[model samples]
Target: MHELIVIEHEAEAGLGFFAGWLEGAGVRCEVVRPYKGEPVPERAGDGLLVLGGAASAWDDEGYGWLPATRALMARSVESGVPTLGICLGAQLMTIACGGTVERGTAGLEIGAGAIEPLPEAADDPLFSALPAGPWRAVQYHYDAMTALPAGAVRLATGSQYPNQAYRLGERAWAVQFHPEASAGIFASWTGTSDMDPLRVADLDARVREAEPELEATWRPFAEAFAAQVAME
Candidate 1:
């Protein structure tokens, strides 16, 4: 069976709906938890999925496995392996490909928000199926991809953060938002940061309300990625 290597940065930010979507598409997944000392693969499988994390991509000293992770991302993209990098993973992909990642001047983009699909996305393998209208997505990141990697095609953009999504090579895709975050996982993220309880509660409610739309928009995207890997 073909495998999709999933890199889970932390325990809390597991694959969520993405795991189920992939499994339903008949693609097996092998998760690697570097935080728990699991080795990052030197070579990728049919596909690679690097999930979200609180840590910055540049914090190699704090997260000793980051350098190796970056190398894995680069290798996967360079070799035309199907790869998807979410949130911090996207930043790492940008940095690994000689792009730039910096603290966002727009402050935190937490909670449910809108992401606009670009014109290039109309023909993209994974993004082509997404709705043409603005899509709501879960956002929780302090850092942003200020510059995309060389030769990358901008698949999507947002008002707060212009670099919302991009396709690196023929098969490598990266997105700044979290399409895989379930309601429970999103709720857990709110309590971690210092914020007003009332505000967190409000955001949690909004995320809950957006669940259906998120599922409609992202579930197909995940399935498409998995199907692509299965075909290879």
Candidate 2:
């Protein structure tokens, strides 16, 4: 069976529905929790999946495991290992591969937001099968990937953040949105935020309403990543 090394940076941002989708597609996941003192391995499994986190990608001092995680990401791209980086994971990948990430000038892009696939996405291994035109996805990030690595193929773009998704080399992919997040996970994130209670409820309700569409859109995306991992 194809196995993926999943790096979980925080308790709140675990794999959630993405894990289930990958497993259903026949990929085994081995999660590494560096937040609880688990050492980040140099290498393990057939592919690598780095999840989103509360910490910024450049905050290696605050999150001690970040340097090692970035190194692992760089190596994964170098060796052409199937890899997926979400949100903060994507930022880490960007910086690790000579790109740029910074706090967004447009402010936090929270709740369900529209993502439009670029022309290049029609040829992408994972994004080619997605629905045409714009689609909604859960977004909760203060930082954005302002620049992508050299030679990276831009796959998708959002109104707030232009670099929403891109492919590095051939096998490594990065996305600024949370395709793995369930409504509950998103609600948990809002609960910890400083947003007003009414606003939080509205956001939560919107995500809950968008749950089916999120599943329809992202499940195939997750499975496509799993299939890519299995091929290696």
Best by lDDT: 2
Q: Can you list the residue pairs that collide in candidate 1?
A: none
Query: Can you give the TM-score per candidate against the true fold?
Result: 0.98, 0.98
**Model 2 misplacement above 4 A:** none
**Count of clashing residue pairs in every prediction:** 0, 0
Off by over 4 Å in 1: none
List, residue by residue over 1-232, the lDDT tens digit for candidate 2: 7899999999999999987899999999999999999999998579999999899999989999999999999999999999899999999999999999999999999999999999999999999867775989999999989889999999999888899999999899999999999999999999999999999999999999999999999998999999999998
lDDT of 2 at 202: 98
| Model 1, global lDDT | 0.92
Error (Å) of candidate 2 at residue 105 is: 1.0
lDDT (CA) for every model shown?
A: 0.92, 0.93
